[model samples]
Structure formats: structure tokens, C-alpha cells
Target: MALVIEGEERISAPVDKVWAALNDPAVLKEAIPGCQKLEMKSPTEMAATVVLKIGPIKATFQGEVTLKNLNPPNGYTIEGEGKGGIAGFAKGGADVTLAADGDNATILKYAAKADVGGKIAQLGSRLIESTSKKLAGQFFSTFGEKVGG
Candidate 1:
């Protein structure tokens, strides 16, 4: 199945700072829900291990994350693909954009698309979509706090 999610957040921090936090693995690891490991392989590439639960299904995903279409302190596209063994696989990408709300605040926006298959997809779309939205909310809320304060 395929899923699409989009949202915007107002971060109480400068755009430059938000941009820096977005590219930092340490920050991402903390913000990402259930992220066990996140390590940079190159300037635009990372290796990750994350545990996720959707409805009655839970899985550990090992994946490669790549950053593309870099535009400096503006935004970029983040793409990732992971294998979860019997749970199945997931591949997705998000187009993120950052705009200055003010000298000390930024508006972060993202539109994401994802596809899942195998056992996880068997859970149905509603459960998967809600779970995905919750995860995304958690990440940004944590990230905003970390970056803003």
C-alpha cells in the first residue's frame, strides 16, 4: 500500500539553526521515534536501524537514508528504504522546505510518500496511516524542542 502525509510546523528557532539540526544525525536520532541507530556514511547518506509498531505488528527496520536536492539552509528531499524481514519492506521520501517565520522562528513543511508491502501491509490502511502520522508528529515535536530550546 501507499501512503501520503503532509504537515507544517512552526519552530521557535532561526531558520539556520533549524537547518543545522535537520542535517545532524545526533539530532535526528533523538527525534526519530524508536531509532536505535543512525550513523552518517557520507555527507548525504546515512545508515539507520529503527523499530516501529503499526497496530498489532512490530518490526525492526535497517535502512539507508539519502539526502538529495540540497539547497543549503532551505531544505532537501530525504529518501529511505528499509527491510523488516517477515514484516516486509518500506520505501519513502519526503520533500522538506524551511521558511523563515521571523529572525528567530521558522516554518518547516514536509510532504511525504511511502509504500509498504508484506505482513505489515496486511494491517490495513487506516491503522498504518494513523501510526505513520503519529510517528511523524512525534519526530517534529521532539525536534522542535531540541532545536528551539
Candidate 2:
């Protein structure tokens, strides 16, 4: 299965602050709804564990996430690959852009693409797309609250 998601969010914080929040493992761990762990191995590399449930199917995925194409207070791209044992695997990336809105505000936009294989692909595209959107919505809602607070 292949899926793409694109959206924008307005944050009540500066671009630099938003960028910092994005890079902080603690913030990520808190913001990702099903994330179990996020360990930063270096400035641009990290390992993560996420548990996802789609209807009757549940899977735990372990992955390495990388941040690249970074431009401070502007934008960056993140890519990751997750293996879900027999359930199969997923690989994806997102391009995130941040624009200053005011002294303490920023607008963020993201374009994401993902590919899934194995048992997951059997779930059908509509199901996968809906689930992905739900997860993305949850992630951003949590992130916005955290960053704005």
C-alpha cells in the first residue's frame, strides 16, 4: 500500500521554537499518540517504537528515524523505516516547512508519503488512508498543544 498525506498547521510559537520542539526526542515521545519510545542516537538520528492498531489488527514497529535537509527556522525532511515482524514493513518520509507568522507564531506545512507491504497491504487502500489520516491528526493535535503550552 502506498499513501500520501499533506496538511498545514498554525502553531502559537516562533519558527525556531517549533523547530526545536520537532528535534527534541522528549517532545516527540509525548506527541506521538502510540509511540512507546524515542531515543536520540545523535543530532539527526533516532530509534523509535510505535504500536499501531487498525481495527482487529495490531502491530508493534521498531524503526530508525532520520532528519535531513535541515534549514534552521525554516524546514526539514524526516524519513523512517519500520519493521513489524511478520506483519511486514513500512517506509516513509515527510517534508516539513515552517514559516514565521509573527513574533510568537508560525505556520507549518507537511507533505508525507508512505509505502507498506506484506500483511498490511492486504488491508486495502481506503482503510490505510483513513488510519493514516487519523494518526496524523492525533499527532499534530498533540504536538500543537504541547508546543503551544
Candidate 3:
């Protein structure tokens, strides 16, 4: 399956603060809902395990995530690939942009694209779209709360 999703999140923090939050592995571990483990493998790389449940299916995905195309306090892109055992695999990337609203506010915009193969693709587009949106919302909501505090 080939899927695309776009979303924006307004954060109650400065661009620099938000950028710091984005780069910090600890912050990401806290913000990513359903994430079981997140380990920093290098400055720009991480290994993670996430358990995702959509409707009647539940799977654990082990993946490597990389951050690149960095422009401090502005934008960056992240790419990841996950293996889900018999469920097949998934690969995706997201471009995240941050714009300062004032001294203590920022707008975060993200455009994401993903592809799933094998059994995962058989799940149908509607299910995939809904699950993606829910996951995105969960991530941003948790991120905003963490950043706001």
C-alpha cells in the first residue's frame, strides 16, 4: 500500500524549544504513543520497537529511524523502515517544518508518505488512512503536552 498523510501541529513553545524536543531521543520516546522502546544508535539514528493495534490486528514493529536534512529551528526529515514478521514490512518518511509564531509559539507542519507490502497492504486503504490519522494525532497531542509542560 502507498499512503500519504499531511498534518500540522501548533506547539506552545519557541521554535528552538520545539526543535530541541524533536532532536531529543528522550522527548521522542515520551511523545510517541505505543512506542515500546527507543534507543539512540547515533547522533542521527535510532532503533525502536513500537506496538501498533488497528482494529482487529495488532503487531510489533522493529525499525530503524533516521533524521536528516536538518535546518536548525526550521525543518527536518525522518525516514524509517520496519519489519513486522509475517505481516511484511513498511517504509516511510516525513518532512517536518517548524515556523515561529512569536517568542513562545511555533507551528509544526508535517507531510508523510508510506508504503506497506505483503499482507499489510491487504488491509485496505480506509483502514490504513484512519489508523494513520489516529496515530498522528496521538503523537502530536502527547508531544504538545510534553512541550507545553
The best candidate in terms of TM-score = 1
lDDT of 2 by residue, 1-149 (tens): 78999988888999888999999999999988689999999999999999998656799999999999999869899999999998889899999999988799888898999999988888888898999888887887788889978
lDDT of 3 at 135: 85
Count of clashes, each model:
0, 0, 0
Give the number of colliding residue pairs in candidate 2: 0
lDDT of 1 by residue, 1-149 (tens): 99999998899999999999999999999999999999999999999999998887889999999999999899999999999999999999999999999699999999999999999999999998898889888998899999998
Comparing 1 with 3 on lDDT, the higher-scoring candidate is 1
Name model 3 segments beyond 4 Å from true: none
| TM per candidate | 0.98, 0.97, 0.96
lDDT of 3 by residue, 1-149 (tens): 88898999889999999999999988899888788999999989999998887667678889999999989979999999988887778889999999988788999999999888767778888988888878877888789889977
Lowest summed-lDDT stretch of 10 residues in model 2? 133-142
* Candidate lDDT (C-alpha), each: 0.95, 0.90, 0.87
Sorting all predicted structures by lDDT, with the top scorer first, yields: 1, 2, 3
Candidate 3 lands at a TM-score of: 0.96
* Full candidate order by TM-score, most accurate first: 1, 2, 3
